[model samples]
Target: MIVTYITNANDECNTRDSRPPKQGLSACGLIGHQLFFHQVVFCAALPDNTRMQVSSKVITGFKNVLLVDYLAARFPYFSAKKWAALVTNGRLTHNGQTATLATRVRQGDTIIYHMPDPEPPADWVVPIVYEDKWLLGVNKPAGLRVHSQGKFIAENLIYYLRYQHQPPFPDVNLVNRLDIHTSGVVVLAKDKQVLRQLSADFAAGQVTKTYLAVVHGQPAPPSGVIELPLARVPGTKTARQQVVGAGEGKTAVTHYQLLETLGADYALLQLHPQTGRTHQLRVHLAAIGHPIVGDGLYQLNDEDYLHWLRNGRSPQQMPLIQRQALHCAATQFTHPVSGHPCQLEASLADDMTQLIDKLSGN
Candidate 1:
């Protein structure tokens, strides 16, 4: 069976080293098994002289910009200097021709940006919560992206799932996504039809996503529904959302119940969002002056957020619980294939558990 891999432009250069070196038949089988699960496979007898070239489609959002400008924006992990160098070296191309820094990319143009390979994180594992032929639910760790993005390709959960579990199908799509810094139960569909059905379930509000969060300050009424419209903050590159007027933004509703009062300044709460909006839970919580602990982006001022992005965390600027103190504790939906109810749960990650224990003096 032929499988397709969407890889960066540097894949061609690394084709020779794509698989582990051969040894005994048993060893080769083990390597092949590992690669199969990850949806990356090499020919049983790869010709020594063969090299495969790979390039990704240019997404529509980046059209009508200079090659250099669009590349910088699309792949923010690459430094301006690196982009300049790549442009100068004529490593980037458009439509099978060498492109310059000033090249204007139109819609549907294929760009070969020849990005450098980033090192994958060391020894990462995604614990399975529930798995069957049609779907998978995993306890996604904080700091692991659901899919490939800017600086994370091989390090993301989808890659790990493909390589480690080697599910029968090549296409595994995320039914839901959590922030890279938020750990929780993430659902994956084994194929396209299941993906479409699950997506419809989410859109029709048939799925329930419950989250656990620790926030600074006690909320009034302790438990209540927060009805707020959310929109992207005006004139900002950062993808930060804010509560807006009813007519101005998408409707977002969060029902929060305070579970425990950790101290005078902190509280543990359970959140159930009725509408799925970008950063809806975080923006709603922060708008009420109870930002999730360790959420540097939503909790801090804009300048502080930019500073945190550039310089990392600071003792004086960041709060306890380094990442956002939020976890998708549970998710509930009907099984798309089994025609039965399904509910999956993930325990609070060790970091959040430890933080809670410390705050509660447990």
Candidate 2:
């Protein structure tokens, strides 16, 4: 059965369906003018002949605002030009009347607009290593974005999960994020409460994360702690992080132990980061002059890194590895719903495994 709700700007909820409550659905919330049933509602298994009617009331804040401007401001995914086309095509409605570009919106007016389904990548898939009613753990592949960002909205994991997964949940949230080039176990929450708990656990340093990395040049002393502050590189739009002095940047610490040497120059290391910072591991390693193998940004000089970004990845230009050779091998945390200990592990991706084999002459 399908469930529908009408939510107003004042956060009032009104359900207009006779569907029985499912297992986990709890309440409704409104973002912009889109009416969404949150927590534990599922619209799946609805009969093919049934039609869905979902809408949200225009917020009461704007007074005498153009309908097009209001829509563009509220839903940033769509541009003003797109909104014009939608308005011209009679696809938008204001209080049950056809909405045009000149239609002025008043407080509490209902604006209804439908968004086209996102065309997610067809071949994108991740292996589900562990799953329960509250959470899902997946071995996410390298070179895959965990969520929509930059120019990769439709090619990300969340979009694929929503469109391709069978019986999709009404709400699915990512508890932790992995870099696009970092292959590892990614945990997703099926319920919002689980998300909050896991988020708090991560914030309080209650979770233990382990990563395996292959870096050029064996680190001296075998194992040690690298405590360094990290901050964004000065005046660069490339999202690069760098190690700074104790007086500046955020405090970041990583404990690393050299596992083995790959031939003469390279080494395999196990990393345990005490604090989570953007590019904490990579920046710390590079700061100590032992950048991870195939890390384009951290491994190269600033000039070379920028050049590589502009020229794209070519074997001649990037002879070592096409992507960073870091894998999130394991994570330990308390299960939010079960209230029990949980451990999740993902083996090294084929690229990292093969790179190690090649370097070790196996």
Candidate 3:
């Protein structure tokens, strides 16, 4: 089990500066901060060795600060009290030595931690869409996370495929990721070479992705391109992306074609994202007059959204659909090994289909 940490702190949007940096734009554009997996720790037990995977990070920006404080600041998933407890229990170390609560850390210091294994959720299902010797594709359900993060480790798709699925695929690696609420076809590589090739293909804009979305209103133009640069909204409690001036944010482009109109209130759209910015589809749709149906985060005010989250994400809060009505309909790419064209697809999720049916009064 190998643990990797993303140490690019400038990608964060929490700072007062609203302008994105000139370089190092990751795959997700300005919203890379929300993709922070610095603190997430996953430990897999080997059959013979039972070796523990330790997550480590090298400090770069800060001067002499208490170790507990640094952990709390860098990894907001855990509180200071929890970090202190971990320090006391010897789960954390700095510079190859056990760290104490009062240990002061400085620049170039390395912090390592041994986290506990995760317990996956029992009631979950992921349907395989396509499978070959080199690759695997699955129709990921809405509300199912693609990767482990924070407290939700084993319940994610990768963990399930590695440990729970029959004829386990312990070495499978994700080629792309989708939001938890977005149901879609997710591609996974069976080996490292395939993973690298597929990942590079995605990063280089060589992959063509198609999506289906149910939005609140019909766009004026039946088909058009949304050429909007996106930047992270700073000074907000939660991470959010917004359209910025032409040269201010990272370039994000999405082409959308209206498919069907559901009465006068809603419409179905087919989307082709030219760039894979975080929440690009949803943000572009919302930037126009049409926000995706059941998108509580984008449609609702911050206060209301927080209230809904606090209330356990009840379905009552969103009546149109349970989750965002976005589905990754298809993906087209070249097979890394065979050098053949590959196109994989997933049907719309049940909830979105049911909502469409109801809107059509069928």
Candidate 4:
């Protein structure tokens, strides 16, 4: 079951704060000037289990946009027609009053949506790697999302850790996230103070992370640095990123060393990213003509990728590997509570191992 509650957009106790109120709503963090809609799921055993979940958001930076247009852009999982139906059914409100299809929302407007809670799959198990008084580390399996997103409200790592684990960690918060197909170690902070410190450390480039990947071809140089700028492709709804002219997009740097060669078609590489950009590792490798094995979005052309997505992301389309071959092999950082250096590691997932073995004729 899920718990429903409403939180003010201007609440001072944000996601980074160490001590949020123990009762009522949970705080969702601010993204620049906009507040992100956050959901907290409670177990069925909890006393106040509810059928519906309430999500509220504060509008900003847009000028007199149609309600349906704004909702479609913000929540792409729901179509404009669906949002219209919800408005017609009186399930949405503007500033505490019922909203309609003709509603034009602007800055400072409050929109509230009441929707049913979705049940997520609960069969997958996540292995705990390390734990202490202030931090917890877990090896997230490939295909497990780090947080709740569209169509996967409760089927995520955080939801399982907080509600489904043998001993629920209700107060824990995520310190880092991995892409759904990338298997690796994920860190969570037990308290707000530790979360804030670790966040600062990440922002300051003090934390170190290493990744392993199997790419289609061998890089020319055994070891080198990739200094490329990346920007989102224009006029695309998927937010695909590509390398841009220097000084045009955000700066991204990565250091890579070839570890082993698999026959004549694939190679294993160890990567260290100096700057954290969205899809930096995958994009960098692809820009250098060695896209990671089974990365359909980056490896295949736009038309083919779109066709694959429309076809339900079938593994037969990508017979080389089931998912991207990249994995977060290790992470090193300073402990927020003890101020001691710590290092955590995760082994490669079985699928990747099998792919390598097949490529090498083992």
lDDT of 2 by residue, 147-204 (tens): 7652233466665566455655445677888898899988889887789999999988
Whole-structure CA lDDT of model 3 = 0.77
Q: Which sections of candidate 3 miss by over 4 Å?
A: 1-67, 81-117
Clashing pairs in 1: 37-162, 37-166, 38-162, 38-163
Candidate 2 wrong stretches, greater than 4 Å = 1-117, 167-170, 301-312
Model 1 lDDT on a 0 to 1 scale: 0.74
Ranking by TM-score: 4, 3, 1, 2
TM values, all candidates: 0.77, 0.70, 0.78, 0.81
Per-residue lDDT over 220-279 for candidate 1, one digit per residue giving the tens place of the 0 to 100 score: 999999999989989876888988887988888899999999967899999999989988
Encode model 3's per-residue lDDT on 1-362: one tens digit a residue.
12322223233212222344222211111111222334323323223212223444545787889998988888777789988998999887788798998798887787767554335343677888899999999999998888765645556777777767787776677899999899999999988798998999999999999999999989989999999999888875566788999789899999999999998789999999999999999999999989999888897778888888788777788977878999999999999999999999998889999999888677
Cand. 2 Cα-lDDT: 0.74
- Candidate-wise lDDT, in order: 0.74, 0.74, 0.77, 0.77
Q: Using TM-score as the measure, which candidate wins?
A: 4
Tens digit of lDDT per residue, candidate 4, span 183-283?
A: 98898899889999998898788999999999988899889999999999887656579999977999999999999999998999999999899999999
Clashing pairs in 3: none
* Stretches of candidate 4 exceeding 4 Å from the true structure: 1-49, 55-70, 73-77, 85-112
